[model samples]
Target: MLKGRIIKALSGFYYVEHEGKLYETRARGKFRKTHETPLVGDIVSFQIENETGGYINEIHARKNSLMRPPVANIDQLLVTMSMKSPEFNYYLLDRFLAYGEAHDMEPVIVVTKTDLGNDVGKLEEIKNVYEGVYPIHFTDRNNINENLNDIFKDKLNVLSGQSGVGKSTLLNTLVPGLELHTAEISNALNRGKHTTRHVELVEVGGGFIADTPGFSTIEFSEIDKYNIKYCFPDFNAYSDDCKFRECSHINEPKCGVKSAVESGQLAKSRYDSYLAIHQEIDNRKERY
Candidate 1:
């Protein structure tokens, strides 16, 4: 059996790349019983059959996975958001951040399409909230290409955002002929038409990038209310200062996170998003 990494899965075949060559392959039958379908970005073992495809024999462990895009073992997520179309949304941004933090993937805040939305001040407003908590790259049509390589350098990064946030446009800019289809935000839908339908890794800038369908919403299925606080990095430094060891930061008196929010030490929007998500998780717990 030869070892390879699955770069794409189409129809019923898995496309595994090994030694610079792609081997069209299929997962072993046993996977069906286990309900384990081979996922893109999975390192798999298979047997090559001359010219015909191959059969994947085993799948290796993954570092992380996202249910929304259904990709695995990614190093970081380029969390792209638009400053104009669809507008800036802290709740959505915080949700992506929480998901990234929960799965141990580094989150890079990338604001694209600053020029399209006609809102000049929106960019600064976005930076004021996220820059303090994460590394942010603010780009427009003018210079996104120049910075693409640096953001994608040496990491298996996923190009992700909500539909029509310029995820494909960004990829096309990085690779001249990539030619990923792009569309304007539908006036009816108020969001970009979904241009990317599947997950496939494209080799670019000394690294691999998986352009996934943009996600407008994400659920905290893997995390519960009690532990969700830790996903917010801003909350970590102050959680230790709370009066009680188990303080949830919402209602607890002398809670460090809340106090920081009240005093402007932390972005009020960030705290509000956290509390909103916290309540969502709380609501989820009571449902069962």
Candidate 2:
């Protein structure tokens, strides 16, 4: 049996790369009995029955998994946003961060379209809110390569952001000949059309990137409330000091988090974002 990693899966066929060669393979019948579907980034054992195709025999364990893209073993999530055209939404960024934290993955924020008269002061405000906790990159033609090369090195990064934020354009610039589709933001609604319909892993700069479908919004109901605080890195220092061991950090008397917010130790905007997410989780609990 030959070993390979799956690069794409579509219509019951898996495209795997083995020893610089690509092969189209189908999973063995046992995988169906086991309810195992070969996903992108999965390492598998296969048998080449012919020159161009093979049969996937076994799949190794996964390090991580994402539902939307249905990929496995992601090392980092590159959350891309724009400075103006479509307007950057911090709430969306927070939701993505929460998702990353829930999955035990690292999240990095990338601000694009720096060449389009982006407000430096506004960008600074965002940086101030998240700088210490996550790595942030501002990219345009002048420094796009320099900035991205540093973060994407030796990691399986996913390029995710709202539509029309130039995600596909950025990928093309980084890895020429990628040939991914690019779409213009709707002039009427100022939103981007979905160009990537399916998830596929592409090799770039000695690393892999999973290009995912564009989304206007993300749901956080899948995450648990008890683990929400962990996603907000800035809240960590004061969370342990709450008077009650099970403090939710909202309306709890003598809560260290509240005190820190009152003392200006944390950005009010960040705190508000936390409260919003906490309330969302609380509301979801009522349903169950």
Candidate 3:
């Protein structure tokens, strides 16, 4: 048996890369009986039937998985946003960050379209707020190759951002010869159409990058509230100091998180996101 990683999955076939060679393979029958569908990024053991094709015998364990893109064992999520054009939505950015945090994946913020006049001072403000917690990269074509090459070196990363934020353009820039489609933002709607229809794990620059469809909505139902605070790296120090033993950091008078917010130690925006997600979890409880 040879070991390899599933680079792509389509139409009941998995394209695996083993020893620098790609092989078309199918999963074992046991996976079908167990209802276990192998996903992109899965490492598996397989037997070569022909020089070009094989049969996947066993699927190894996964480190993490996301339903939207359906990829597993993601090392980092490169969350992209624009400075102008469609504009940056802090709420949406926070949601993506929360999703990464919940899955134990590193979140890196990549701000695109820096050439578009950097209006409204939003880019600077975002960098100031998030730089302390996560790495941030700024890019336009002039410096995109340097920025992305430095960031994605020897790591498995995923590119996720608002539709018009130049994700596909960046991908094309990073990996030349890629034919990923790029679209213009609608003048009337101020949004770009979804161009990437499927999830694909592409080998690039001696590492792997998954190009996923732009997401309009992200759900956190798979995450539990008890562990949510851990996702916000900035909240770590204060969260441990909460007066109550079981402080949820909401409606608790002596909550350390709240105190930090009042004292301007923690960004009000981040705290607001926490409260918003907490409320959603609370509503879910009521429904249950």
Candidate 4:
């Protein structure tokens, strides 16, 4: 038996890479009985049956996984967002950051299309809100952020964002000769067509990165209202000062987060996002 990491899964076969060699393998029938499907980025053990083919017999534990693109063991979530085309939405960006945090992946914000132009002071506003809170990069078609290139090293980074955010173009810029298919934004809907159909970890900067299909909506099914606040890193600084130790930071008296928001220490947009997401989770639970 040999151990390997699955790089790609297509047509009922998983392409596993072990020691610089890739072997086409299929999962054992037991996985079907267990209802556990093998996903890209899974570290698995398999037995070789032929020169190029094998059978995966076991799947190791994963740090985290996502079902939409069906990937596992991701270390970084590159929250790619566009500055213009579809327009940047702080709410959506916060959702991505919180989602990544809930799943134990480090979140890095990458704002694309700097050349597309925005209202005066838009860039500074973004920087003001997220600069000290997370690692963020601003890039355009002509110049990829230099700082962006260094974060991929030694991490299993996953690129994800809303459609028309230029995720594919950014990848092509970062990795020459990549030539990933990219589509123009549809003026009618103000969204880019989905181009990435499957997830495959491509080597970049001595690390692995996968480009996932862009999505507009994200669900917080795995996390609850009580725990969601922890996902917002900025809220951590003031959450402790709340009168209630188990403060939801909503409707709780002497709430430090609310105080920060009122005093202009924390962005109101961030507070609004927290309320929206908190209400969303509550509404979803009520429906169930």
Better of 1 and 2 by TM-score: 1
Between which residue pairs do clashes occur in model 1?
A: none
Q: If scored against the real structure, what TM-score would every candidate get? A: 0.87, 0.86, 0.89, 0.91
- Candidates 2 and 3 compared: the better one by TM-score is 3
lDDT of 4 by residue, 92-124 (tens): 899999988999999999999999975659999
Q: For candidate 2, lDDT tens digit of each residue in 182-204?
A: 75533223233232235678777
Give lDDT for model 2. 0.78
| lDDT values for all models | 0.78, 0.78, 0.78, 0.86
Identify the runs in model 1 with alpha carbons over 4 angstroms from their true place: 116-122, 184-198
List, residue by residue over 159-262, the lDDT tens digit for candidate 3. 77767788778888887777566864331242332322345687776678886534445677887777777777898879888988778888888888999999
RMSD of 1: 3.3
Candidate 2 versus the native: TM-score?
Answer: 0.86
**Position 86, candidate 2: lDDT:** 76
Task: State the local distance difference test value for candidate 1.
Answer: 0.78
What is the Cα-based lDDT of residue 185 in candidate 2? 33
